[model samples]
Target: MSGENQAKGNAQSSKKANCCQLTVDEVGLLKLKLTILAVLCVILGAFLVAFQVLSFMRVENAETERMLIEQKNRNDDLTKENTKLKTGLQETERMLIEQKNRNDDLTNEITKLKNELQGGKCADGWQYFDGSCYHFSTDTKNWTESRDACVTMGGHLVIINSQQELDFLNARREMGDGRSQRDFHWIGLTDAEEEGEWRWVDNTPLTDPKLVQPKHTVLTFVSAQYNSHSTQFHWFWGINQPDNYKEWGPQDCAMIFAGKLYDETCRSLKRICETKSCMAGV
Candidate 1:
């Protein structure tokens, strides 16, 4: 019985020893598996962080490219505006130059006109009156011959326009040294084209018949003194003159005697009166 009991105890001790060895092996294997799992978790976390960083960089690059494109567009617009301004400025400069040239031409024209107005003159031995020159011929000739003579002197027969001009001619005639008050001088008036339609040498018709009245009253002083009696004289015509007198072969010309006008033969000899515009001086 005692030996059997000892064998059973030894057998139990061997079984217990085997069981402890198995437990140790199992714990060691568990520790190795934990270590491997920890290393794998660290590698996975590192990969996730790298992926996030790459995504952020891509977003920043996209934003920078967009800004660069916008800046390029703005620069192009400014260049176009600058080109337009330069063209407009050039056009304005051209207009200013043209205006300056026109102003210079106008100034030159004004200066020439001023010089002409100040330098107007007339020939010597010609009387200047009313912006015209007059020449009274001393030689006697027919009406046609007198007119030709006036044309040779660069003038035409005198044309009386106003009462003041007639008065001036009368005063000049009274002041003549050897002129008679009754002396008849050939005038520019004529009716050769049509009877009773008097016209001047300039082709201007007589519009006022009062200028050639047959008679008029004149007030004159009898003595040379200032306190002399005033006398009246009658200006008369030669017996119904300008009656188309056939006796002298159709008198169609006009003459001036004193301050009166008369019709006479065109062939009659008379002094001439010529008139022309004043000449411009150099």
Candidate 2:
């Protein structure tokens, strides 16, 4: 009975030892589990911080790219405006150069004209008088033929404007033999368009009161009328002048005969008196 009681006490001691060992092993396992949890928390926090930094860098890069695009647009606009201004400036310069060239040409033409005027002389065979040139033909021709000849010589029938001019023409007339009819030269006056009205070769009306005559009135041969107030001599008609005499055909032309005006048939042969501007000879 003693032996059985001792064996029971030993069995109780072994069971107590086994239970203590099991408790120590469980505590060590709990400590290892806590350390693993702490390491996992640290890793998660580092990953979250890295993600935030990367997102911020991406946003900044996008903003920088947008700014560069806007700056490029502004540079392009400025370049277009500069090109337009250059084109306008070039066109203006070209127009100014053309205007300057035209002005130079006009100046040269004016200078040449002035030089010609200063010479104050007509061509050879042309007599210069009162800023005009005169040509006297030695050939005989009818009134119409005489006019044509004068035009061919670069002049028209003579128009006597003043007493001095008529006197100059009278001094140059041909004097025939005393027994024969007086030599006559064709003048610019004519009454062919209308029987009563008279005009000059230039289509100017006869306005000089001294030279006007009563229509169809026969006049006696007389000297020219003198104006004492102006100290000038005026034209007068000869005997039976401007009668429209049909015996020798219609007398539609005028002639300077012995320093007097006379109506004569256009078919009558006569000398020519032509006058022109001095510049015409030049």
Candidate 3:
């Protein structure tokens, strides 16, 4: 019985030692599993943080892109406006140049007109019209003596060229220098060289004898009336003028009295002279 009891106790002690070893191994395995799980949790958390940062970065990039597009559109609008302004400026410059040119042309035209007006002036102490010069004298002389006086003064007796000249002389007669009532002026006309034939001092024959001579057979005559409104002289001669009537003896020379032409004796009378004329500045 004592030998049996010792053997049994030894067996029981071996069993208890085996049980403790098994318990220690199980505890070490549990510790290793916990450490691995902790490491895996840390790795998962790092991945989640990285994902969130990536999403934020994407949002920032999208906002930046939108701003860039808006800036580009504004730049485009500014460029178009600049182009339009440049075109307008060019047009305005062209119009200003045209206006300046027009002003210069008008100035030149006015200057030319003034020069023409000043160039055609007549000389002093002489009346000028249609390129001719005239001089009226107060002294009295016979027709022949009057012509000689005009020749000495570098001129000739007055020659009635056109009716306009006749009107001009009539206007002078009306202005009478205090001697119009009885004053008569010797003109360059006479029928002295040939009987009933009138001629000027320059020997130009009378083409229109009605202006100076009248027939004796005519019962009535017409006289000239000056029409101020028309600036012309209309003829309605006096009754039976220039009839070469027997009472007026041997009338050869012509003279003017009160703006009327008359055949008169070559007696003393005022003389009118004419000369070749030149414009002052021409």
Instruction: Give the residue spans of candidate 1 off by over 4 A.
Output: 1-121, 212-241, 279-282
Candidate 3 ranges with C-alpha deviation above 4 Å: 1-124, 209-213, 217-239, 245-248, 280-282
TM-scores for every predicted model: 0.45, 0.47, 0.48
Residue 41 in candidate 1, Cα distance off native in Å? 99
Clashing pairs in 1: none
lDDT of 2 by residue, 221-276 (tens): 34233222222424356644667777978888888877677788886555545665
Q: What lDDT, from 0 to 1, does candidate 1 have?
A: 0.69
Tens digit of per-residue lDDT, candidate 3, span 76-118: 9989998889898899889988988998898889888755554
Whichever of 1 and 2 has more TM-score, that candidate is 2
How accurate locally, in lDDT, is each candidate?
0.69, 0.71, 0.73
Clashes of each: 0, 0, 6
Candidates in descending lDDT order: 3, 2, 1
lDDT of 1 at 246: 62
Model 3: ten consecutive residues of lowest lDDT: 220-229
lDDT of 1 by residue, 144-248 (tens): 887787778888777777666666666665556577676667878888999877788888887654344332223234555423222232222233445566696
Candidate scoring better on TM-score of 2 and 3: 3
